[model samples]
Target: MNESTRQSSEPETKRQGLSGNALGAIFMLLSGLGFTVYIVLSKTLTEDVHPVFLAFWRSFIACLISVPVIMRAGIGKLKTRHPGLLLLRSLFGTLGFTLAIVAISADFDLTFSQFNAISFSRSLFVTVLAAIVLRETVGIHRWGAVGVGFLGVLIMVVPGVFIFWAASGGDGFSLDLGTMTAIASAFFLAFAIVLVKSLSAELSAVALLTYANVLSSVLLLPFAIYYWSTPDLETWGWIIVMAGVGFVAQYCYISAVSVGDASFISPLDYLRLPMATVADLIIVGMLPGMNVWIGAAIIIVSAAYITFRDRNKKAQKVKVLTDR
Candidate 1:
């Protein structure tokens, strides 16, 4: 094998047994679980909590918790110090989060699996957005992969409505404002994630996180007031859990992204379904039938292909820059 072949083969070889890999995997899985629980909890309220209120409170908690850590790191280390970009990130990320909550409130609402599918679409969006924003070349094979991913979304959604209609016997297609909002949330979030990832290169993860939360909390204070409802003790408890878990999940998730090649990691991203499917079955007594399973399979496969292509493209670009 050539040097490049040998280099690629070695990472595969090192994973032959359990090393420290278990710890990272465990943390990642925990992170996933935490985020999933947050989604499930959010969906439990009967509009008892407004979307804006959820955003403000959750972000407020995150910012409050993050402040001490940021201080300990000193003012300079809090972030990369790009004010313009940080400002923009905060604005866009807040908008994304706000819109996402609105969408969730409007749609099928959240389950563990559904949250994963929607949040993970961010990765897919990054690929397509990068092509446009950066003017990067997109190969046909890459476009084909994007098409396949969308096909999977269609599969999951179309039959979903039909299944609802059938379940009702003579009702109608389950097209509602909430469902459409959920779909739109998925689309916009994908774009938001791409923007965040781009800015990530120039910012500290904590900084990126802190600004988004703090600024969002500040910006949302006025709007969140109108929708504020008296959350019961149970609701408050869930909010606390959601805030804490969300912080931990993002922290560890960023760590995972740092250590592993997204190409390799992205494929394992498919494992979200199995994890969430199991969670949903246990928590909500809902197991996906054959249709959801098939659709998920297509999405997983396409996502893997897209990640592989993106990594290869990125590597080539880095190589050219280094050679220059």
Candidate 2:
């Protein structure tokens, strides 16, 4: 190819890449908003329905939502050589999703924003888990970021502990089950992320999701059935809405990652924090406490730093390799 031709083509290629990234950012934003609704709807429903039953419906509805995708991909696409790891992923993913519902079911007196803030702790957990479980070499910057992130978590959590104590007239400091379950949700989610990193090479994303929904539905079925109460049509509508939004959010997230670099798309997920706060104010008439704002800022900054730094490092490595 002539030099002038190649130079002209480069700009076009760059424009296409930029356009793709923009599309991805939009998808990720919609995903964040969808997830925000999912949280609010789930919280609203906790009044009459058991979380276990809610989780079961979530899985079942998600599976129903996936039917078209699964059919389009065909049965062959669902086959995976890594069944054990997929099972492990299903186990942790199920725990993470169900525990999140369980956490919200508890009367923590927290707004949806405050409750959802704990979910961001998953990134910190993923960093540590990558080092321990995957034996991935994490640099000093990442480690430092993880430390600061945990400090932010403490900032959010310790204040709540104090508030609870004062409210209970000095009933000695103890973290409530709701809070612990939220943290556990983050932990399980992190583990599932690590497992995904391992299994991504051997399995298609569709296959992984297909198994996750199907297996979680089966796992939660007994508990869901035991606690089942027939929801009125209105409540059923809300449940379907919750599950539909969640499915859309999941689809958008996957589409975003497929189109753009994960690092580039990840910062968009933080939009859920503010979205949740807005949903809280509008739906529940609640404002987040100062601790949530302060700690969430710290966590978001630390996570963004980690993502950007890692992206730069990867870019430099690619450049060096290309030059050679």
Question: In model 1, where do residues sit more than 4 Å from their true spots?
Answer: 1-24, 78-82, 105-112, 159-175, 316-324
Candidate 2 lDDT, 1-324, residue by residue in tens: 999999999999887755767889989998998988887788778887898899999999999878678889888887677888888889999999999988877455556786678899898899899999999899998999999988877767664532443455333323567778888999998999999999888677877788889999999999998989788999999999999999898889888888888787888888888898898888778777766787788888898888888789889999999999
Candidate 2 segments whose C-alpha is farther than 4 A from its true place: 1-18, 160-174
Residue-level lDDT tens digits of model 1 in 31-150 = 677666665555554357887788788789989887777777776765564677666657767776666566555345444565555455555566687798767677899888878876
Candidate 1 pairs with clashing backbones: 106-178, 107-178
True lDDT of residue 320, candidate 2: 100
Overall lDDT per candidate, in order of appearance: 0.67, 0.84
| RMSD vs true structure, all candidates | 5.2, 3.3
Residue 208 in model 2: lDDT: 78
